[model samples]
Target: MKFTYKIDEKTELKMLDLQESEQLFYLTIGSKETLREWLPFIDFTQKVTDTQNFIQSTMKQYSENNGFQAGIWYEGKMAGVIGFHKIDWNNKSTSIGYWLSNDYVGLGLMTKSVKAFIDYAIKDINLNRVEIRAAIGNKKSRAIPERLGFTEEGCVREAEWLYDHYVDHVVYGMLAKDWLNKNKIKRV
Candidate 1:
């Protein structure tokens, strides 16, 4: 699958690679406390090598058509990462995951990037369903799905393991038919 997505003049999503692991590692380390609150894997990435291994694994997954992770770029800098956890080819569904740098919050960059990916998933990839799961109390993360018009399907109690404890996850879902209809009206 193609890896790069140009959302606009200032925003793009590019497939992450091993060479960029150091940069990604530093970003994660810098945002350790903030990111760790919601992401459990952050605790395992102790050094650059771990980041390299993670990126390498993701690259392999991309080749196998399982899933992918892309670095979100804003104004030519790595702002965050976003992508599908996996594509359920049988069910024509997928789940999205993402995180933004502390500095990039409130810029509407993530919302736009996510919207672009959802468009690609539904229109280009022909996916029937796309889902996002945000840890409970993560208003910032939850807002992306809400702003894009996904339905709040409910929550899974203690669904995600953060650093210290489990956190409930609010599930949001959107169907391609609904997204298509919405976009058609927008284009009219």
Candidate 2:
């Protein structure tokens, strides 16, 4: 489970040095100012340093489990985060999630990033499928998959609680073949 690779900046937006989509920004690490900007969008009250430490620690875990966790760069700084979690190499599946700094909302960077990541995962990593789940009512979060052509699998009622509230979850997924077919059409 050695997850080590130099992701090309052009091929992987997560690795890009300049991340901007009109009004949004992206970065891997944030400065003190960035911390203040993103603090509210963050679901936890932990210090910025704590978040950084958690990123480092989780990266190690992802490496151990043979997966990837990439920082979503927005504007000229770190505006949000996204990653592939719980990779099952044997089954060639992974779960994806993301959060945006409040300032970067309404832009379509997540959709772009998700599509790019999916392409990377399926073609580069040779994964068979990728899944995305969001707690119901999070329309902004859930739209990423729908806009990218993922099929709605179903709903999981009260599957997990977030911010002290039990939330329903929606699952979306895409297979490698479907992804390839869609890309082929786009190239036509």
Candidate 3:
């Protein structure tokens, strides 16, 4: 089945398939230096086949009801990827991960895309909580969750290994009730 979610007329999220792996690889290549600063897995993706393997794994995640990663297409071009990490069903919670090509920054694209994911997690999937964690020094990445009104829960000291060193993360969380209330959505 086809999986697509439109964030707006100019942007949409589509589940990645093997055929689009090359495009994704190129996007990563173009943004490598910048992406590597905040994302730990960038070094692991040194080839197109790595991207394909990622897609295949995400497909498995979808089939197993874990969660899926999706390509963020902007005006029909592969701009980035955003996805829910493996879900904690018992807790009705999940986290989101995203990266945009350096070329696509500052266009309000990530903000819009994240809003859509939050809506899906809360309204579509009946999830109770959504969280985002970003390296403390990565302002741009942290802004998405902040702009979307997620609460700054706290910090995890040296939470991730970037490449050679550790980077602390600022945790942001949004509960379904708070998100719905903020959006003025009432549950039936």
Question: Highest lDDT, which number?
Answer: 3
lDDT of 1 at 39: 83
**TM-score leader:** 3
What is candidate 1's CA lDDT for residue 64? 88
Model 2, C-alpha of 164: deviation from truth (Å):
2.4
Q: What is candidate 2's lDDT per residue for 11-65, written digit by digit as tens?
A: 2234211122222222323332434332333344334454455556566766486
**Tens-digit lDDT track of model 3 for 51-157:** 88999999999999998998999999999999999899999999999999999998898998899888888988899999999999999989999889999999999
Model 3: number of clashes?
Answer: 0
lDDT of 2: 0.64
Off by over 4 Å in 1: 185-188
- The models' CA-based lDDT, in order, is 0.90, 0.64, 0.92
lDDT of 1 by residue, 1-188 (tens): 45899999999999998879998999888888888888889889999999999999999889989879999999888989998999999999999999988878889999998998888788877888999999889999999999999999999998977767888999999999899898773321
On TM-score, who's better, 1 or 3?
Answer: 3
In model 1, which residue pairs have backbone atoms overlapping below 3 Å?
Answer: none
What's the lDDT of the predicted structure labeled candidate 3? Answer: 0.92
